[model samples]
Target: MDLLTYIFFAFLFIHIFKHIFNILTQKNHPPSPFAVPIIGHLHLLKPPLHKTLTSLSHHHGPVLHLKLGLRNALVLSSPSAIEEFFNTNDIVFANRPHALAGLHLGYNYTSLPWTPYGHHWRTLKRVTTINIFSSHSLSLSSRIRNEEIKHLVERLNVGFDESRAFKKLDLKSVFLELMFNVMMRFSTGKRFFEVGMDGDEKKRLIDTLTKILVPNTKMGLGDFFPLLTWFKFLKLDQKLIDLHKKRDDFLQSLINKHRNHDPSISTNDTTLMGTLLSLQKSEPEYYTEDILKGIISMMFTAGTDTTALTMEWAMSLLLNHPEVMAKAREEIDSKLQRKNILEESDLANLPYLTCIVNEALRLYPPGPLLVPHASSAECTVGGYRVPKGTIVMGNAWAIHRDPRLWEDPTEFRPERFAAGGEGHLGHGGYKFVPFGVGRRGCPGAGMAVRVAGLGLGALIQGFEWERVGGELVDMSEGSGSPTMSKLRPLEAMYRPRSL
Candidate 1:
């Protein structure tokens, strides 16, 4: 009886000590709003999550903690705070949050974007950087980008009304197609999303891609509340399951096509898949077909959509601010090395155009929250304790529009990026992380910049664009994950520019 009493006392003492330790560690945690049971701040969240979080940051300081359902999210809105997270505590937050998309679309979390920081992920990152995103790799892909831009020019020219020379064209589709074609040509050596191919196949591919993408964009209930994952009688999970099947089938068909092809017969062998296939012959274990598919998946989803959205947003901003559009056109026309066709290299000559693109990125970053990083271990952010397993998000949207960091933050001022610009991409540390920062930042940033700049510059140089009507284009923010896009597709009148 005495021994039992002593054991009970020891157990009680240990529990008290642990509770005290937790209290001490949590003392410096960032401020949070009142949270309810189970759902926490999940109810406070609304669509266009970036905007919502930006508002929250304004109230709860630049860095704060929130209970997002069962998940704890540490949002960093200040530039210095973001720098500390990505710099000093980078490796700690290098891990990715477990989401349904990672399970379905990310190839069971083994893919580069979804995988936790480790040897395998490191290998994928190295392969992506060296083989795809390096300057040399991009230089090799220049021919493809140039060819696709010419196709865009031709598409725009033919679609417009001949008599008036003004047509209300859906530039959203045009830019999307341009990006899709560029990505496909780069990845699979095929041109998809262009006019006059197989109607059914086109519809199938577009529909399938849209379905797959829409789910990822949604802030699903299961993500914040894991218990809800099993109770998905709501059909979200079913839809995802269906999407996974379709995507698998589609990608498998492409893989089989490459697999069955006779290497000698294929004249165009410079495709990314083809290159990977060749690598597979030597290192089959490391460079498996699944890894190739994962790489393709990342490239196709990331490469196509982000550039398309940037171009769309840039075009929309220009349309609303006609003076900016006119100024950009003037810059393009005056200094363009090739008046007939603007090459990717020509983007360097147009400083104003670069400013326009940068400003557009500032206004609407493709990935506003920088892809939901997670803390692998406890760390300090903004001098506060960030517990292990907490979600760490850099609010690029907030930082971009922070009145402290930018003058006329809401305005479309491309000149802000000029000599006296308040926020310079290079100088602003984490203040201007549109493409993100540190180790887990987008690896495809180099290629994405080249594509967006060239695409935007060429469109400006090649066409005379006018807003459809006197009314301003509706710049409503849309739903997207890993990218923020304009809700309404940009429609505008266009005519070919005279040489």
Candidate 2:
């Protein structure tokens, strides 16, 4: 045979072999969207992504699989599907969704939220749970929180109008102040306004840092593409590095001050940074200084905004549904009438208040996506193959609003969590996973509940709240990574209630 004829035969054989291989691999996984070449589903996403995903869920089933460019994103929107994540295949979804925020908060992938499944993540989780988020730590911090709460009450009292019987106040700033002080005490053993900065500088610096940390714009192409991350188009990569450095410098300064304690002065049991430093001494390799800084940053990013956002939502919901608010207020006032202050133990008797908080969390989970989870190993869900390292996100918003799980899912009715109610917040209905589930669920759940419940309950007990401008509260949500807060700050008038 001629050499040209042999070459033609070889090319044809190779083409046929490639076709056969494609057909064989096609059977391994279920069908998905026709992902566009460069941008997959980027154009399909609408404003308020939660609503869009909810609509898509009805059409695509509970566990809809899709591609976000070469990246894979599985949108799980049902109780059963989420149950599979928490109970059946918990270990499979142990990793986190690799996003810009995770990397930023995790300090270049050192923290738990951004770390992949393995020794590093497991060690971090264990240390955090035992040393930082334990019940003992929370009880110890109660005195500190009470001190801050006292200041909050004093500020509100001074803000109230003595002549008019009611005065307008912006609850957002008040809550922000309270949370900022609390987090500062926990992080640096000092307050930003108290020790770090004076006059307007404190507020200005905090505001600027907050804006940089939580930018509204979509992350540059680097975050998603990974390959082009080194490119400097929007200066995103450089900006993050700069922000990290700034934050680290501030945190380290605080740490150094704590280290150089005066012999004459005594300190409280030890701050979060102190504990992290102690941990660093033992596990030098894993718990390095950078890792400690990342943990502090994560706590700040996760803690402050969400707690205040919940307060805004709960207050707004109570005002809108006067009956629920009235009932809750009555219960709190009656129960705590004798005591001058509200206690965490009082929370158990106030089931209705608990229900209301649950409902708020359901309607407006602080973290809409719940710190994305990644696949540790190759797995399949709802007949789709998910290879290892694929980023997975549970649509907490869609699951919370799933009609099949709750009656009138969109409505903010706290009755659903009452005794014999259809869907209790915890346990069975995995749909209302505001704190997420599985081993990596928010370790600060107990502290969050106590602080949120006590703070909000205090507001209800101490004052009668109403819209300041004689307008109804707008229930629209604001945009943010991790936390979906109120777009418009909740402004209200306060009138001290008669005992």
Candidate 3:
């Protein structure tokens, strides 16, 4: 009985000590709101995290640290802080933790976005940058883009009328087709939209992809509270597993079929899968089947909704601001009026068009919070010691709009990035980084900009766009785990050019 009493007393003493230690540590770290001990500030997050975090940054200085449940998150909003990461500690901050969703999606520490910084990551980056995402590959893909754009223009042209006749159309389908077709063509040498898909099949494919790409409230129970994971009745685990199976079945089938065929017999350039498959023969271990799938998945996930959403926002911004729209259209008409189509080469000469795209990205970056970046080693960011494995997210949205940096930051002003105008934040440089900065920044940024420029320039040149019912276009943001999109689907009336 005496021994039992002593044991109870010791347990109570240890618990008290732990609480005191926690209090001390909490005080030393950056100041944050009073949060429930275990849950941290997870409950504070609302639909548009970009806005919320930016507001928080305004209140809590530039570099704000918070306890996100068991995870540690650092939100960097200041340019100096961001530059430090890009210049001084780029490699140290390049690693990323594999989140539960990433695991359930079958990436399992293999995806380029989640892979740790090491040989495997280096190899994958080399393959992605050099072999697949190279300048050559992008140049080659221009033909595919042109073909898809032709279809888009033709589809819209059918709505033309000499009088005040315009068609109110859903652009979601058009953008999805453009993105998905390009992704598949690069991955499987097939186009999901081009050949024999019925209306229902096309809808199903689009629906499935949309469900996966957008963030949902449904994922919270698992992400925040792991104890609930054992209860499979929720079926969250099963849903993710099913998504994995469906994705793999489709991708593997393509890889297998390509493996059987002779590359020499194919007249077209080898797809990304073909190149990776060929490399697999030379380095089987590093280039595993899952790794190949992860790479492709990264491209698809990274490529689709973000690109589509940016175009949607660009058009939305133009619709809301007719003056800006008029200026942009004038530039497009003057530059490419005689030509049958807008070429990628024309992008360099159109500085104002580039500025318009930059402004759009500033307003709505595909991923408001970039793919979670993890610390590979101990480092100090903004005078705080960030231990290894601590998840670091540089709030791109907040950085883009920091009042300290930008003049009239919230307003949509494309001229900010024009040739002579001081770019974002009143700095005479590429101050706004929607694609992110540093080595782990989105590799497809250049391609995304070029595609958006050509696509937007073409639409402006070929058709006259206006809001439906003459109502103001709502610029409200939508909910997503990883990306920020327009809450209301951007619906606009388009009429073909009279000329």
The candidate maximizing lDDT is 1
The reply for model 3, stretches above 4 Å from the true place, is 1-19, 23-27, 159-164, 195-201, 212-238, 260-269, 424-430, 479-499
Candidate 1 residues 220-306, lDDT tens each?
766776655654554556666777777777676777787787342232568887787787888998887677778888887888778
**Candidate 1, residue 454: lDDT:** 84
Worst 10 residues of 2 by lDDT: 481-490
TM-score of structure candidate 3: 0.85
Cα distance off (Å), candidate 2, residue 353: 1.6
TM-score of each: 0.86, 0.85, 0.85
lDDT of 2 by residue, 327-433 (tens): 98788867876356556668888888888888888898877766667787877766667777776667888878777777898898988888888766444668678
Q: What lDDT does the true structure give each of the candidates?
A: 0.75, 0.68, 0.70
**TM-score (C-alpha) between model 2 and the true structure:** 0.85
- Which ranges in model 2 have alpha carbons more than 4 Å from their true place? 1-24, 28-31, 99-105, 159-164, 194-206, 212-220, 230-236, 262-269, 282-286, 479-499
lDDT of 3 by residue, 215-282 (tens): 33133546554544655666646767777777777667667777777342232337777777777888
Say which prediction, candidate 1 or candidate 3, comes out ahead on lDDT: 1
Error of 1 at 353 (Å): 1.0
Which candidate has the highest TM-score of all?
1
